[model samples]
Every structure is written in C-alpha cells, then in structure tokens.
Target: MSNTPSPTPLAPRRTVVAIAAILALGALAAVLILRSGTPGGSGAEAAHGHGHSEAAGHADGEHHGAAASAHAHDEAHADGEHHEGGGAPAARKSEAGHDEDEGLIAMDAQRMETAGIRLAEAGPATVRSVLQLPGEIRFNEDRTAHVVPRVAGVAESVAANLGQNVKKGQLLAVLSSAAVSEQRSELLAAQKRLSLARTTYAREKQLWEEKVSAEQDYLQARQALGEAEIAVSNAQQKLAATGASAGGAGGLNRFELRAPFDGVVVEKHLAVGEAVQDTTQVFTISDLRSVWAEMRVAAPDLPAVRVGEKATVRATAFDSSATGEVAYVGALIGQDTRTAPARITLPNPDGVWRPGLFVNVELTASSRQAALAVATSAIQRMEGQQAVVFVPVQGGFRARPVRVGRSDAKATEVLEGLQPGQPYVAEGSFVLKAELGKASAEHTH
Candidate 1:
C-alpha cells in the first residue's frame, strides 16, 4: 500500500452525491408522467383546437361534440388545476353543457315516452281544503245530568250501577232524612186546622141563610176558612219539594233519588247505606244520543276553522265515521300549546262516540280550484329549504327545484316551477333523492 493513509477510503462524499442525483432524475420523470395524464397535456390541447375548428365550420356538430368533450375533460381534470383559473373554467363549461342537454325543454320530450311517469293535464282540480285537528270525544253537555239527593241522609239503597242505562224518573237511590219527617208533621197540622175551619164555615153559612146571624160574622168565618186553606196548600208544596208524599201519610222522610234524564250511568260515587251529604252526586248520567268531539286547532289555523263548518270525526275504536258541524270555537288560545279549542257535535244514536276517547277530526274548509296538483311523493325535500323533483329527459333525469303550495298527506299543490301536462317522477322520487344525497356526500368528501 502506498503512503497517505490508502487514499482515505476514496472519500464517501462522492457516493452520496451520485445517489442524490439519481433520486432527482426519478422525481422529474414522475412529474412528467403525471402532467401528461392531465387535460392540460398536448393531446388535450390539440383536441381543444380541433373542437374550435369544428365549431366554426358546423355549428350543430360542434355543439354536441363540445358538450361531450367538455364533460370528459371535466372528469379527467377533476384533480388537476393546470387548466384556466385552476379548474373553474372546466367546471363551469361542464355544468353549462349538461344544463343545455337536460333542461326543461328536453325533459318534456322524454316525459312523453317514459312509461314509469304518469302525466295528468294540469286543469282545474277541486281541492277540498281541510283543517286537521287533534280532538277527543266528550259527552253532550246538554243531555247529561247528575242525580243527587235533595235531602241530606244516608243512602239506604242504590239501584243504578256504572254503565247501566236508566230512564227519566227512574229511582237511583233512597235516603232517610229527619228534616223530611219534620216537614210532614207541619203538613199534617195544617190539614187538621183546615178541616176545623171548613166545618165552622159551613155552620156559619147556614145561620146567615136563615137570617139568624149577622153578615159580618158569617164573612169572618168564611175568611178564616180561606186562610186555613191557603196554609194547607203551602205545606203541601213544601212536603213535595223535600221529595216526600204529602197528606200526613208515612214515608215522607224516605227520599227517592230519581234520574232527571234518560241516559246511561257513567259514574256512581255512592254505595248502598253510604253516608251522603246534600251536595253529594250519586250517579252521573250521560245521554249517548248526541256526542261532542273536542279538538285543538293551532292559533294560525284558527281562522280557517269556523263554527257550522262540516267536520268528520273518526275514532280508532270504531270503523265508522261521524259527520257533524263545528259547534264552537274557543275565543282564547291555550297558553302552553298555543292552540284554540274547537267542538264538533255528532249524533251518536248507537253510543259509538264515547266520552274520553281519542278521535281524529277533519274540518272541511272552503273548496278551491287548483290548477296543478301532484302526489306528495313527487316532491323531494332538498337541503331543508329547497324542494326538488325529477323530470324524465331524453338521456337521463333532470332535477328541478319547485315552489310548493298547500299539501295534504296524499297530494301537493304546485304553486310555481311546473307547467300543465308535464310529466314528473312520482313513485320513484326516493331513488332520485338518494342520488342527490350521494352526490352531495361525494362533493363533501
């Protein structure tokens, strides 16, 4: 080995420089490969130039070719920003081309051929405006009554049971009262006094006729008899008022509680031999011939619901529906719910409209002419604020934003954005909505 430390292992710096140079060359190659794959490459430029030339020569052919080419270029350059304004030009061009091809004019033609879409002439349709309300069934206030004992005493017997039908004046219970016995005694005394006065008056009348007595004496006896007769009549009325039989006969203290109205007993608060007060309600009777449906209407919808308007009440418990008129609309709105109360009166001859039952109330508002009405399924909610509908086009479906009007569970009135005799997707609208959602998610990602 020669001196000078064997050339110091040839200095490793040279090896390092060679490896870095090779890496730089590989990176440059990769950059060229990526640039050629984009729309800004020479091939794409040449295609654009050819398109311009064709556009100047044959306008129709150029239009179609330009649209197709632009669409392709947009897809190819989606990740690249080498084109004008970093991809805005391609995006705008692609969108414009798509709009021209699948616009409203184009969709109308495809609607005529699509079998899945149904087209109805948008003429005047009779739309019966309806006001939906939350309601509950209640008893008819006019025909219901509570049977209570007039005199305070223990309930000796109870003839009416819960849910039992009773006729007017039917005995519900019997009560014994000391107060009733005292009134009977007064009536007996008044009757005795009246009898004695009548006997004395008869003798006095005989004396006057024979001219054996003065006219003033006979008149006094007759007046006394009249006073006694008035006293007896007063006592008889008092006894009757206490639910007792008059004329000194026993059973005056035994009071009979009778039904005031013919109805079914809905509530019974007292049992046989139960202690009762004067104000204690024994039996609650409700006539089922007529019932009321009480409903709550929102404050905003109150204007449409008017008294005497026709309403239909449906109960889940029964298959039949009742037709009635709006009987009342409350003047005040509920503080918590901000809703107003409305009542519908319906005949319940079969006792179908039971109280405390929940029912659906539909108030029919004034009917109006609707120029165009589509099934509610035809409208798709987009972005919460906008509504979209798919219209069949020549190549594909076109999405349209529409302004909607009154809508019920079944149909929706088209206020703007659609025309007469137009065909729109109705049944498969959910498919279009899913597509929109997918597109939006893809854009976000």
Candidate 2:
C-alpha cells in the first residue's frame, strides 16, 4: 500500500512465470506418474493443494508406488506360474511317448511271429493193419551145409576161402588119409582076384558043358570062382562108400572134399597142412539166394500171422527191402520172450539178406473197412481213461473226446466222437495244448 507504486506489470510477469514453472513441473510430474503407472483421481489433486497436504500427497505417492510395485511383482509371479504350468503338459506328453516306445520294444523281443500251425479234416481212410515184430534173417537150413570130414586125415590143401561161392561137387579141400589108402588097396586086390576068377569060371563052364573033364574038378573050379567073386564085390562096395574112384592110382591116399550144395562158404575151419578129424566141420556153406526171416510174434498177435501170410522185412544197414511169405509158425511159444516163432522165406537175389541180421518185420494181420481214420499225431492223451482231439472253431479249438479203435504206428481208426470231413488239428496241436496247460496252471497257482 505505501510506496508500492503501481507494481502491477512486474507482478503480472512474476505470476505468469510462477504459473509457467508450476505448469511445467505439473507436466513433468504427469509424465513421471504415467511412467510409474499411477492411477489418476480427484483425491490426488486435493492432497497436493496445501503445505500440510503436500506431506500427505507425498505419502499418498509413496503408497501408490508401493502398491504398483506389489502389483508388478504379482504379475511376474503369475507369468512364471503360467510358464511352469504350460511346460507340465509337454513333459507329461514326452513321458507318455517314452512309455509307448518301451511297450513297442517289449512286444518285438518275444519273437512270436515264426510259429506255425496246421489243421486237418477227419475223414474216412484206409487204415492198414500193421503188426510190428522183431526179426532176424537166417540161413535156410535146408539150403545150407556143413562140410565134415568122413574120415580122419591130414588136410593137404584148402581150395575154398571164407565167403567164397561154390557150386555143387566143387572141390573145397584136399585131404591125405591112411584109412583111405588101406581101403583103396583092398579094393584093388579084390578087383585083381575077381578078374582071374572070371577067366577060370569061363573055362570051367565050357568044360562042364562039353563034358571034357571030371565033374568034381569042374565043380571045384566053379566054387573057387564064386568065393573070389563074392570077396571082390564086398571090397568094391567098401571102397565106393569111401568116395574113392574105381581105378585112380590104386591104393592112393589123397581124398577130394567136395561141396555138398551150391552156396557161399560162410565159414572155413580147415587150412593147408592142418590135421582134420572125421567129426570136424571143415567148411560151412549157405545158399544166399534165399534166406529165412525169423520173426518173434507176440501171443496176442499170433492169430494174425500164419503160414503163407505175406510179410515185409526191413533192416537198418540196407536200404533195400525183402518180400516173403510165412514159411512156418511155431506151435509152441518161446519160454523167454513169450512169443511165437514165425519164419518167412525171403527172396535174397542180391544176397543182401544175410544171416544174423537184425530186422524189423511188418506182417499184414487182417484187412477191414474203416469209415474214419486220422494220423496218430492228431490224437493226444487226455484224462486217465481216454483221449481227445481239438477241432477248429470260430476263434479257438474245441476239445473233443474220442473213442479210438485199432491203432498202428502211423494211423488210428476213429471209433467215435468224430465225423467224416470234419476239420481238426493234425499238426502243431501242442500249441493249443500248451495254451490250455498254461491256463490250467495259472488257475491252479
């Protein structure tokens, strides 16, 4: 009021400047508030108006800053939680994929793809009645021979060796014997006497007929000739029995041993320069063209085999076979084996059927009609009293009990529980059986 001389212009300028500065500070604070993410409200302006309120404004700004900081922290925590939650699904999916891969690996390791199975149909089949018998090939006794010395002698030379084929009357050995020489000498002496007696008898007969001499002299000559003839006949008969020739080196000691039959020399006991006895078997000869197969037939199977029955014989050593007919059936059973002896006459043209060869014999017992039959492998043992077979079904096999009739080593005749043309498992039936076994075992466990 006193001397303040019209300060209007400068006051206006000062007011303007103060207002501009305040406006500028307000603009900067607005920018800072925007950067700080502070909420705009009318309560903030009232808080900044007075000096006492300035303190409250600052306190309010601090409170807003602390709330903004807390909100930002909460957002960061939420983002981290979201990221962790998003990763959980991918991790779970990865673990699930690994599990699936493991499952595939496990499945591939078992090698269950190579198994095979077969099925068959039940139908009418011609089942042969097969009789199995243990047999042995033997030499035909009638066609074989044992060469024995007829007289005691020393063996000079043996012409036949073991397993040598010989014909009838072929020389087998040569023997030297004193007894043969003595018999030959006696024969020669008898023959000489007989020749002289024959001449004298002829002269006596002529004299008697012409009446050129006395009756007593002629009768004495005839009687002497008759006695000499009788002695000669006896000596000749003795030499002939000893297998000696009539005129070969009179009184010779050499004897020729001949084969009695046409056969192979299976055994040779005499050698060159070996002593032989009258009872010694010098050679054994067997006819290999025909052999005998001796088969042991059980008592139960005896009726099926008879004389003249056909049989087949097989041996392990030879691939060839022998066909024959039953030669004889023993009336008595063997004491040890409880079997009857059946002999078959086998044709051994190739000499393959040797004696003492172990063989398997198949005898045709009897033939009958069968409506249905199957391989023996199709039938499996089931319970204690019976058996069964698996018939094919929709998804599996149906176990069917069957009544079996006559069964050979190859096939079995179906008596019941099967029909013609019904499909069944013929091979690889053990798989189904094992499945059922496993099921039963699991149940029991």
Q: Which stretches of candidate 1 lie over 4 Å from their true place?
A: 1-122, 247-250, 296-299, 316-320, 331-341, 365-367, 374-404, 408-411, 415-445
Q: For residues 338-380, what per-residue lDDT tens digits would candidate 1 score against the true structure?
A: 9888898999888777799988888766576678877777888
Q: In order, how many clashes per candidate?
A: 0, 0
Spell out the clash pairs found in candidate 1: none
Task: Give the Cα error of residue 340 in candidate 2, in Å.
Answer: 4.0
Q: Taking the tens digit of each residue's C-alpha lDDT, what string does model 2 give over 302-393?
A: 88898888888899677867778999999999899898888999988887888999998888776666789877887888547568887866
